[model samples]
Target chain A: MNLRILIDRFACRFSAFLSVCCVALLALIAVGLIYKSWPILLEHSLSELLFSTIWSPMKGKFGFLSFIISTFQITIFSLLIAFPICLLSATYLVELAPRSILKIVLPLIDILAGVPSVIYGIWGVLMIVPCIRDHIAPFFGYTTSGYCILTGSLVLAIMVVPVMMHLLIQVLQAVPHELRDSTLSLGATHWQMIKLVVWRKCLPGIMATTILGISKAIGETIAVLMVVGNVVQIPKNLFESGYPLPALIANNYGEMLSIPQYDAALMFAALILLAVILFFNMASAYILKRVTKSIT
Target chain B: MMKHKYFKKLEEQFFFGLMQLATVTILFGLLFILFTILWKGIPNLSWEMISQKPQGGFYMGGGGGILNAICGSLLLGLGSTILGLLLSIPIVIWLNIYAGQYSRNAVMVRTALDMLWGIPSIVFGAFGFIIMLALGIKASLLAGIVTLTLLILPIMVRGMDEVIKTIPKELHESTLSLGATRWEMATRVILRKALPGIVTATLLGFGRAIGDAAAVMFTAGFTDNIPQKLTDPVASLPLSIFFQLGSPFEIVRGRAYAAALVLTIIILVISFLSRLITAKYQKHSR
Candidate 1:
């Protein structure tokens, strides 16, 4: 009996220690990344490494300007494609869709959300890439392989649509039913009611969702890497091939061992990506907290 | 007034039509992608593809199957899921049963998890690589398992936390009033109440771990054979697809699609099964 009590005391202490360890793990990742990249950061001028477009790590030049620009371009392009459609679909689902229709549509979105990114990458390779190469790129007079920023953006847009839509739908639904009824009773048309009442009220929620979508698009690796021609140059146009930060690390991390400062450079890239993603996540969380608090 | 009314009606109809079109696009896109994968992949999938290990020159259309990748993926998923559960369950228990719902520590933990959840898998890979370098650990099954554990920890914890939070406080108080220790309350009462949720969370984390390519790409060095030891390299389905699709051979590309089809089916089955389980059991909880 005394041993059993001792065991119980140990169990309680162990459980608390596990959670504290998890929190420490997050700090460990951040510190480890910075520590690993310290060699490159110490040797290379920070401005030259970040601002210059040249990125031939083979020759020990390591400017990430091209990749950063491309990551932004593709992320913005995908957000442009995803935002309007997601907003409309979400609004329709919240304000207009019949219950019977929602039952089907909601599940479909959930399934899409669950579909793996690697599968999305494969599909992009087969369908979106070819179609862009044959049909879309020609219209732009861009002549090259099908892999380009446009193709990557299109695939990413598809991947993020379900998630963006889900969040927007929830935000829209969370605008109290009484608010909708009040707006309708004010002689506003259904569209007007949604425009003035629902959209206006949920703008912060919408911002949160948009930030989440941007973060997802920016961080997406396999699908974007599969389609984004991954040329180490800043894209002059959407039809041109360009590299992004994640793709650069993915494609080059394996070969870094043979190259000087390559691993450090890639670690720097990873750090940058982590920083951007964490910033967006924190912003969204802050907004979501505010939105939820206000609602409550 | 009549003109304005007509314009309002037209505007509403137009936007609603566009929304409908967007919804259709989402559904159609999903269906088309699924159909295309199955259509292109099914013909290439044979019993050998599922059961046999890849032979030499497999990526160049040589003989052999993706058996190594299939097993590796299962092993990684299973290992991570078990580890993730072991870590997350205690965290969930601590938050609900120990820290209480409104504790400052609970809020911080949840916020940290939210931040962690938003991190991309590639970042995890890089972090894992750094840790591995520090520990003198080579890229192996153990490295992959550790990376995947961190990757899925947030997902598992958050999922199970939400579920545990739904268990009414009255149950906790009543159980405590029965003179049971907190450990007993956690193990017998809280665990039983949240078992289905914990299972769902495990399945969710497992799905994420199995499907992720970026997190395991560096840590789990790809090999054509299953690892005999934790220190050996293991191939995964995502990395297999990534490698195969990168190959120049038409036959290898076909096999890539076949592998993708397999991975997709596994994820779909898991999602469906979890949903069914949740639906079946959640009814009783309420």
Candidate 2:
């Protein structure tokens, strides 16, 4: 019995140590990236690095203004496109769809979410890019090479819909049946109850979901990189080619490290990406915590 | 009043109609993507493509197949999934068993994992590359597996954590009351109850590991032959498709679609298997 207790104590300590290691891993990543990027950080002021647009690496200038703008433009536009559709789809699933439809649609969403990002990249290259070039762009009185910010946004919007809709459905379903019934008993129509009660209750959750989606979108590399044309410019319109931070790192890191500070500039970009995503994730977590607390 | 009521009813109907349309539109987009891949890929996806490795000048529309990439991807996926599982299970066991479920340490760990999950796979790749540089290691299969393991660890941990949280509290109490030590209870009872969930989480990590390209792009240098040792360079299906689709040759582009079809089928099979496992094991749980 004593031996068994001893073994249990040892296991407990070992597992606790492992858990501590898991937490430490995050700090380690942050520190490693900072240390690697320190050289570039020392050479340039943070404001200049963020705001300047001249990106001639061989000449030793690394302005990141264009990449930052493009990242924001693509991410915000995609979220604008995906949020409403996800909200509407979740409402339909929770309030209107029959059990049989739910059974099918839920699994479909999971499969869609599971589809690889690179496959989405392939599909975007083959379908969305061409469709935009031949049809959508022409209809809007502009001609594009089928690779632009709009193409990236459209593909990303689709890529994010399944995950966002899945979460929204869960949030909507968590509304108490009694709350819905009470609203209906007051003679409000179905949509009215949804607008007044259900939507109101899920507002924090929806906000959190949107923030999470933004984090996901900004960090996506291969799919957006494949379609965004990789031009070093701030896009003036949806049809214009642009570059984002993740794309910049993925496209140029290995081949160009021979240039002085090139590796450090790339590492700095990675650091910025890491910091932005961490902020958004923490914000979402805070919102979600409030959501659970108020519910209980 | 009658006119106002009529207007409100019309508004409700209008918005409801829009909801249905949005749902249909999303579903149609998914089906259209699958259809496009099948239509373009099926004719080119031959038996030889899966069985034979790429031959000379393959990117220039040469003969042979992507057997190297297929095997390499499978090997990397399996390696990383096993490594991730070994790390994740202990972290989760500590979270649910040693630390109370709502303890401060548990919350801190969850937040760290959540932040880690939001970091892009590309960032993971970059960080892995940094580590390799520090250690004076070249891009190899081992490097790829390490990076992929970091990329998928949070996913597996959170997934398994959710599953273990669902196990009834009474079960935990009963196991301890039967004189089972904490270690014995964890391995013999809780682990048994959560076996199906653990498998699903493992497969989820495997799917992500195999499908990811950016995380392995720099860490796993592309090669024509499968690696005979951990230190050797490796190829993967996503990178294979990326390189092939980038080719100007139409034949190579066709092969990209074919390779994509293979990747998609693998993911679909995993999702289907996980569902089946969940249904089968749910009856055994409380």
Candidate 3:
């Protein structure tokens, strides 16, 4: 008994230490933010960093709020385009698809996940832009210019399809077989059972997953930067190119000189983005766990 | 009874057809995108093109070869992945063996790691540039490698943590019952069982690092030739593609397509290998 107690005690202590060490990933995030932004902080006071609206990197003015708007506008639009398609495809795959077809479909999605963002950018620039110019632009009275909020939104939606699909498929597949089993066993139609019972049980998990995918889309930089055209202005139309916080840094971080505060403002953006993403992730994880456990 | 059975068969066929169509739509969409570049770009690919930097003239002339860019990506990716793993392994072990059941205490830590993972690679690019300036690393491979370590460490640690946590507590108890030290159990038992999963996590992290362009763009700078020393400036595929696409010339743009295809193929092969490794080990070990 004494030996058993010692063993258990040892296990508990070791786990705790491991937990703390793993947890330092949080400190690394802080280090990353500070290490990148401290120069900006030292150059500009906190108040100026948060509230200022001037963003000339060459002359040393750094405004973060405007980029924040671009980030949200692009993110929300992408999620709108992606969420429905992904949900429908996932719904079909998890609830309705035959296994032979699913075996092929799942790996195809995996292949999509593996494609690099730069390739996506290539598609966007070469195909998407011209399509917009020739097709979508005339309808909207803008021709020959394809880089804008909508293009970013469209490409991002395409990029996010797999991630959202993967997460939603996992959650939807986990919905108790009996919940639907009983509903269907009652002679309810397939669509009706899915709509009324399976969806109701899986709503929280779906919401959590949706929010996580949105946060990821928001944090994206390379693909968006490549295709978004980096024009620095508030977009009056979806087709007009504009910069977000991520692209702003991507375009100017290396070129900016002696502007420590400019760097700090970039950190401010990082901190804001980090905070929003963390909150979304935490909420999503919490909701998923609760949903999964409650039914189990 | 025969009539009713015929209707049921019809219903099954209708539903199966719809599902198959949905499946086809998604699969074809992704495949079309993948093949678009390779189809358009492959005719332009050649050994001469591979040996030179992309320039203003046709595909055959000017600039320099991508020999440097490929080497840079491999070096930066491998170096950072190795460094990040070394730094985080002890943490994973500690959390698995020592944390006991009170993991909620580590919630903030895990949350932090997730935030890092989500911080757009561009944001890291911004921050990495700051550190490079601060330390005077100055667009060198060393700076890029260091920045990538920070970007990838959180992911590696979290992935490994999840795998380690999945090790049944019984495994720990049994190993310790053999009169092994806590460290012995960690080194000899828990880690050995979890090695494949840990390796999977590392490979995924490495792939993410290699495919990443925005994070390393500012820190690594653009060098077209392979570096003979760690301190030298270097370019990567993503950066090369980015700069090429951003160029004013159309020929350069086409070459960008070619390069993008090469990078995608590389990424696809890496991902398939990771999937194979993970699936193979799990199937055999179980």
**Top DockQ hit:** 2
Q: For every candidate structure, what is the RMSD over all alpha carbons to the true structure, in angstroms?
A: 1.3, 1.0, 4.8
lDDT of 3 by residue, B1-286 (tens): 9997678667756755665565566666677788788887797666755776534443333554565667788899899999888877766766556544337655556666666666667667766776676677778888899888878888898888888888888988998898887767887888888888888789878888888887897888886568778899987988878887777776677677778877887778877887788889879877
Q: Which candidate leads the pack in TM-score? A: 2
* Top-lDDT candidate index: 2
Candidate 2 lDDT for residue A199: 97
TM-score of chain B of 3: 0.86
Chain B TM-score per candidate, please.
0.98, 0.98, 0.86
Ranking by TM-score: 2, 1, 3
Task: Show how many residue pairs clash in every candidate, following the order shown.
Answer: 0, 0, 23
True contacts kept of each: 0.71, 0.81, 0.47
Interface root mean square deviation of every model, in Å?
1.3, 0.9, 4.7
Candidate 1 is graded, for docking, as medium
DockQ of 3: 0.37
